[model samples]
Target: MRICIVAQTFAPQEEGGAEIVARMCARELARHHEVFVLSLGMSGDRLAPTGEATGEDGTRVVRVNWHNSYLPGHKKPLVGRIEKARWHLKASVGAVSAKEIREIFAREQVDLVYAHNSARMQPALFEASRQLNIPLCVHLHDYALLCPKSSMFSAGGNCDTPCLKCRVLTSRLKSDGEGMTAIAVSEALKQTYLRAGVLTKADWHVLRNENLREDKLHRPFVGRDSARSDIFTFGYLGALSEEKGIEDLIRAFVDMPNRRSAKLIIAGRGREDYVRHLQSIADGAPVTFMGFTPPEEVYGVADAVILPSRWREPQSLILIEAAAYGVPIIATNLGGTPEIVEDMKTGWCYDPSVAGSLAGVMEKALKIGHGNWWAERDKLFPGIRGFKGTAEASRYYERLNALLVEAQRPDHLHLQAL
Candidate 1:
């Protein structure tokens, strides 16, 4: 089968979590089938540039600019609900954009269309797939279809219930997404969309994302000495955003009495102001902000990986990396985290809501050396097949091919949830 992956961005141009998954997916699937990519370029808000190029992964990628108020990139995201809702409302409708996709589908003779995050390439995307009479598979990476902010988090807190603005903005999106096949990274994400009355006629399956660390096999196990409790190092290695709980992580690290014996290493870059704000709060504390550091280098010296995300991560790559590298995880008990992290057994979990909850866990990890919690790595992550990540990769394609065959039947639609 020939496949065309439709995403907002692709690798070699962008290296976010979603792009990495799309790039790896194209390569992995190419081993069995021909693969092509339809992605957006790094242009400004203008909807120009229609050309084809080869991605760094050596996959053929067709890059096109978006037809939106502004393309989402390194810049600050749209602020204010009213302004954000307006952008989504306008970006969703583009008859010309739909025509462009249909033309690409016909030219490529694409057998199936798999969509990752269609930030400004929606409604038209669904229409194109329907017109081509091909299977449409939507990968649920975030809450973009349910909420305009994508994270379902705004105004310094979480949105448990949809506000009036969200209802108005997502009504058309929910209608457009009703009957397409979907592959959610976590069961929590599937249920979230289901609870919102979206994707009712569509088929749903969960496939956890595989580890994307380049040094997955190269990095030595972090905590080999479980009993040695010397000067500790805690690492936070993702975007430095507010919803990511970067501020909260710094506060907990600073307030803890055990902080004197430990240091915090923050890697990854964000908006300049936000990164500066985080650095300001972490002033005088034993914190080092290594901007844009790779995952392997961060995990190299760190004793434990910290994922203090306040927003519910559908499936955090950081959490998955900690497990794969034989490093103990210290994360919040939210979203897909608990599914992998067992309290006091695998690693430590903290409540992000309650005051002092995160600090308490910080002290716990400090008291008990990192290697102590994970004495036997194999017993802890028994599902791990090897350092090369064969388990999750094989399961992804295995389930995908089986689902494609199953979708051929008339009455029943089924797929296994890994």
Candidate 2:
């Protein structure tokens, strides 16, 4: 099948986990089927190039430039917010030409359009697919359909209900339309959308994000060794945003006993103000900020990793990656995290809401000792197979395409008409 993987951003310009997952899925799909990526380009120029280029993985990528008067990449406080809002508004109304997409679909003879992180590209492509009689499947990586912020996290907790602004933004979001299928990275995320009345009319499936390739998993496990090293190292790798609980992680680390002997390494980038605030709180503590360390380097050195997310993290790829590296995890007991990290068996889970809860968990983790950590690793490493590779994930996409094709059959339509 000739598949067009649509996303807001692709690799070399990735902002988060969604892009990584999309690239991996696209490359795996390309092994068997022809794959094309439609994404936005990151440039402030008015007439930046908007055309096709071969991705690093050999897949063809078509980058579309957002040519709105409202600067798409502007970062000024009030003006930037307004520009982003205008861009999203324009995108929702199909400002990006449907004719252009139709022409591309025809030229490529695209069999299916698999959308991942289409917040920037908007629902225009979805409508175009419907008009062209092309089957479209959307993979939900975040809550962009229900919340403009996309994390469904605000102030300090998961959003239980949409606010007035959220309702307005959600109203502007285009519907999935008839015959569209929705794939959620986790069952928790699926239920969240279902309860919010988002994607209610579409078929739903849960496909966990792939964490590591089989070849990458061949490295020797790095279990904690308390005897070899006097200081225990705890690491946090990902975006340094507030919703990610980086502040909380720092606070918990500072409060841990014998923190002088233990070290906290934070490796990611976010708002400088937040980073400064974290630094202020971490003063006098053994904390090191590596800015942005690659995942391989992070897992290689850290004794354990912490995912102190305050929101309902829909299948954290870091948790699986850390586990795959034989490094234990200490994560919040929210959303799909528990599904990945079994408390006490694989890693520890703490309540993100309760004060000192994460610190308590961290203390427990520090006491696990090298011997116990290895024992847990021995048990959990075998189960890591399910989350390791993209081969199975690609097969899921293939199955989805077959199901969609069958649903579009003339006889199937006739049966449904009865």
Candidate 3:
């Protein structure tokens, strides 16, 4: 199988969860099959002088600049429906050019196109998948395919509201015409393309979950757990967006009765204004904004990991990463979170909607103490064999291969009509 993995960002550009997954998957696939990555470079960055290089794992990578011009100078507020509508419009146009993509498709002769977040960064890929008659595997990193905001979080930081607006509405209105619109259109186009039978004949919809690697279950914190007794640590790793509940995490930590010894370590960067706001909210609590550390390090130092996501996380890699390290999790009970953490088993879950839920959960988790956590770790953790990365990766490929076989079958046409 010759697979071309497509994503808006990739290694050497950004260290996002999606990028990490794509790189690992592509490299692993390359061991058995021919895998080439087709990724977009940052707008202003040209190819490095050395050009393409083989990854340590024998995977080939090719980076192309696909940043949209609308991305720059388009960042603004979405106050009303009309403004939100217009913002989605220009975003849809600039993410990727169909003409440029077609040329790449013709040249690559890709057997399968695995697209991550193409709804925004590469709409042209959807069109190209149709034009080239290539089997397209769409990976849903989040709810971006179904909701404009991608978090499935309602406006004004609420989540109870049912999904109403599609990215198409935003795209059609040309409200802001930025990365946001490109994002919405990706979802809108995904729904449209699926329902309209545009890519119904394609290979698969690859929705990635957290890195459920259970092999590292015994890998505990490097230092003596008892030695760090005086210090209490809470971990939150992900983009520091307003919708991510960074604000709430700050508030909860401040509200915590154990605020004296406890410290909050936030990793990842986004929205400087929001970060500043969170800092102000911190007041005098121990909050450290590390701004995106490696996944290993982020999980290494934490006594317990906190995923205070206000929005529904399709799945949280942080939760999976922490679990793999046997770190107790304290996350919002939303989206695919339940799929990962069994309440009071692997870790604790709290409602993001409630004010003191996070604070309460944290206080209780702190009481459990790290030394005593191992006895309950197995109860919380998934089966070691099932959760191993090798097993998980194999399942992903099996599903993907099955989709390809299904696409080539004659009965698919009848099913397509229905």
Runs off by more than 4 Å, candidate 1: 42-48, 74-86, 176-179, 211-216, 219-230, 343-345, 370-394, 404-413
User: How many clashing residue pairs are found in candidate 1?
Assistant: 1
As for TM-score, the candidate ahead, 2 or 3, is 2
Could you give candidate 2's per-residue lDDT for residues 327-393 as a string of tens digits? 7788898888887677324577888778899888777766765456555555644444333333343
Best by TM-score: 1
- Which is the winner by TM-score between candidate 1 and candidate 2? 1
lDDT of each residue in 1-418, candidate 1, tens digit only: 8788877765554466776777777777787778888876545323324578775668888866566655554443658978865666776444137788888889999888888887457677777888878777788888888787788888887777667877777665664344457888888888888888788668788877763534344545532334233567888899888888989999999999978889999998888888888888988999999998877676676777789898888878776666556566788887777766762244668888899998888887677655554465446544332433333543656666565545433443565555
Model 3 lDDT tens row, 16-89? 56666667667656666667777654434533211255556666666554444322111333358665555565
Off by over 4 Å in 3: 41-67, 70-88, 121-123, 146-149, 158-165, 169-230, 369-371, 374-418
Candidate 3 has an lDDT of: 0.58
Report clash pairs, candidate 1.
Answer: 226-372
* lDDT minimum window of 10 residues, candidate 2: 409-418
